[model samples]
Target: MASSPLGRPTRGTTGTNRLRRNDRWIAASAAFRRADDPLVVDLGYGASGVTAFELTARLRRTRADAEVRGLEIDPVRVATADAQLAEVRAGRTPFPRDLRVSFARGGFEVPLADGRRPAVIRAMNVLRQYDEEDVAAAWRTMATRLAPDGLLVEGTCDEIGRVASWVDVRPDGSPLRFTISLRLAGLEHPSIVAERLPKALIHRNVPGERIHALLTDLDREWDRAASLSTFGATQRFLATVSALREQGWPVLGGRTRWRLGELTLPWEAVAPVAGP
Candidate 1:
């Protein structure tokens, strides 16, 4: 018969909208927007398939033909998601009865049939359980299955979806960028994302590490922009990010994105000092 799925099971902890930030990111990404096939995979989607359902809803806003496949290594989790999907199909759930989504049993290998390659594979919180040393290999395995212009988004986020960080890897398995997205309302320091860094960089958030330095600089700029808090958190975050760009932090995107409490930089800016 077939071999078992290629990765460990998740903690099975997930909540509604826990991945909303990530879904928006992917919806806006060039890989998804420009994909010829527009097929996306939600790898290791936990005990529920809601994330995949939510992802399809958001993506369809940009590409009506966008499709999402939720893959879980645990067959039981797949069955549960299939059941939930059935409810959705029967119009018993809030999701669109015609929502283009499916559930399957798979892992980092991202097993698509008929030699099909996905345009994007989102593996949020999936690698957190793997050792840091196992990250590169996993990235290669997953990235290899993507379309030539596809992307692999791997990262971690808090349960409520407020704090998040991820690495964008190309189909060749080379990481392209690192991003941190947070909720600015009632906020604290931006370095709070340190706790939720992807497995590749989580342990590298120490002194002398690039990721550590980035967080340190972010916290400093956030404090420097404290006076702007009177204008509101979004304004304050805009100033903080602008200050980082002025300091040559190589921040990506513009005010529109900064206002959403996002900061993106080349992977080289925060790649581990030694390696992932």
Candidate 2:
């Protein structure tokens, strides 16, 4: 008999467009845009498979051949998503009848047939319930399933797509970068993302931690840029991120991405310092 899916059931708290920000990130990522196969996996897609459908639709804008496979450890969730996919195929749902999407029972193990490997595996909110100590092994298990040069995006977000953060892990199971994406409108502080950080860094947001310092410095710059608010939140955020880069934060991307309320830095920027 096949081995059981290697994960616990998700809390199943899913909503429409909850992962829109993440989808946009993946659509633009090199792993998906440059992949020869363009196969993406939406691991632990919670109660609804809508995320997978939405991801495929968004990615199709960039790569028409992009495909998404929604995986869930709970067999019930898989069945539910499959049913929803049938509706899409019958043209009863708003999604494209030919939406390149499928549903399967899986978890961190990411079982796939035909020796297929995904260009990107998005595991949002899947590890929030796991212990911090369990993060590395989980990342390794999932990352090993990726195609060469593939990416493993693991992170957490709120119910809405407004606040999100993810870590880009290489196929070798090592983190490459950390990114935070937030809605800039009426934003209180950039550190608001601390609440939704990936499991690996969530507990590390304490004093003396690199992540804590990053958030602290980010909040400070946001306040300093408050004078630019009259220009608009996007402009204010642009200034904030620019300041961070000036202070040698190793911020990645340029104004085009900063305009979208995104900030990416090498994982070392906020990686947890080794423990005693």
Task: List, residue by residue over 1-276, the lDDT tens digit for candidate 2.
Answer: 116888898899899999998999999999999999999999989889999999999999999999999999888898999999999999999899999899888888898889899999999999999998889999999999999989999999999889999999999999999999999998999999999999899999999999999999999999999999999999999999999999989999999999999999999999989720
Report the number of clashing residue pairs per model: 0, 0
lDDT, residue 175, candidate 1? 95
- List runs of model 1 lying over 4 Å from the truth: none
In model 2, the worst 10-residue window by lDDT is 1-10
lDDT of each: 0.92, 0.93
RMSD to the native, candidate 2?
1.4
Clashing pairs in 2: none
Worst 10 residues of 1 by lDDT: 1-10
